[model samples]
Target: MAAHTAIARPPLVPEIPLHLATEITPIWQATEAWLGEQGIEPPFWAFAWPGSQALARWVLDEPGLVAGKRVLDFAAGGGLAAIAAARAGAAMAEAAEIDPLAHAATRLNARLNGVTVVEAPGDVVGSPCRWDTILAGDVCYEAPMTNHILPWLRRLAAEGAAVILADPGRAYLPGAGLREVARYAVPVTRELEDREERVVTLFRVLP
Candidate 1:
């Protein structure tokens, strides 16, 4: 994991250090070669996406929101938001990821930032809500993935968990039941996204 990445801070959340790839193509190729398959999911864990960057910034700036609360960073790429939540005094911070490499990256990054983030590896979609607050960043990009997680997320929201989602205008984001709470213009590289920056919106998922 350390071989392909460098310890760098994300543009929006500079306080936390992450092991991130400098370019997309090389990392993608490397991931494919390492995994021995071309059909695997993109190495989303290697880059700090716009949504997670915004979430981390918001959590750090407004620590009171997560202070003493049980927080979860769902689909946590590099566990950026989880690190921020821990730094902001969350009672417990957890990061959930299906990808093994993402889990490793999260563990590595958490250690780099000197924070303890419990790893919730494998599929946690149908699990009972163990969190007081949940941060899902850039999760609604693909239709199938959006469909798979939305119902469970809505259920979590209905069960009184404050499920917060940060979106950078992904096509699969639902049209309703989101109350906007914050917005950020996150800087991004054109290699990953079409635009050089993305306006990420944070929403409270309403049940």
Candidate 2:
């Protein structure tokens, strides 16, 4: 078995405009069979989820809202939301993922979109630095993860930061206090899971 190494946080990169190629780009992610083919790894963050792609497409449908805001894309697999926020004119865009491979993928996707994305991880949570806006997608499918992240999000929102989540009615999404901002019917492939279709809804955390 390959031993895991200590997690090292990477530096933040600059911001850039949205790319035209994102629309045509095929979002290929690892499925259960695919992971088995490649020899499944312990860390789950190496692969991007279908819900994340759904959130990304939903973000693309909106413009002008994120301009000039400090944005944090939490659990940013493939940095889809980070790239979208940057394209939408976020002043500083950071992609936070705990997995090293996902961090690398975030950087690669940032470059592919001609954007500079900062890579941060879960360890950065509760740090002195605060973002004007925080975005999370497909993060609440698991009860433990949702329980862990919900308090952090609430704390951030309580501190007056704008927090948003794009979820496909995942089992763990809190039933209260999220205002619907937008919705999208995302075309999903079976590359990530059994679900071939999903309706993603964006919500704004109210103060």
TM-scores, all models, native as reference: 0.98, 0.74
Give me the overall lDDT of model 2: 0.65
Error of 1 at 70 (Å): 0.8
Instruction: List candidate 2 segments past 4 Å from native.
Output: 1-50
Clashing pairs in 2: 18-87
Residues 134-197, candidate 1: write the lDDT tens digits. Answer: 9999999999999999999999999999999999999999999999999999999888898899
Q: Which candidate number would show the highest TM-score if scored against the true structure?
A: 1
For residue 8, give model 1's deviation from the true position in Å.
Answer: 1.1
With a 3 Å backbone cut-off (N, CA, C), the pairs that clash in candidate 1 are: none
> Which ranges in model 1 have alpha carbons more than 4 Å from their true place?
none
Q: How close is candidate 1 to the true structure, as a TM-score?
A: 0.98
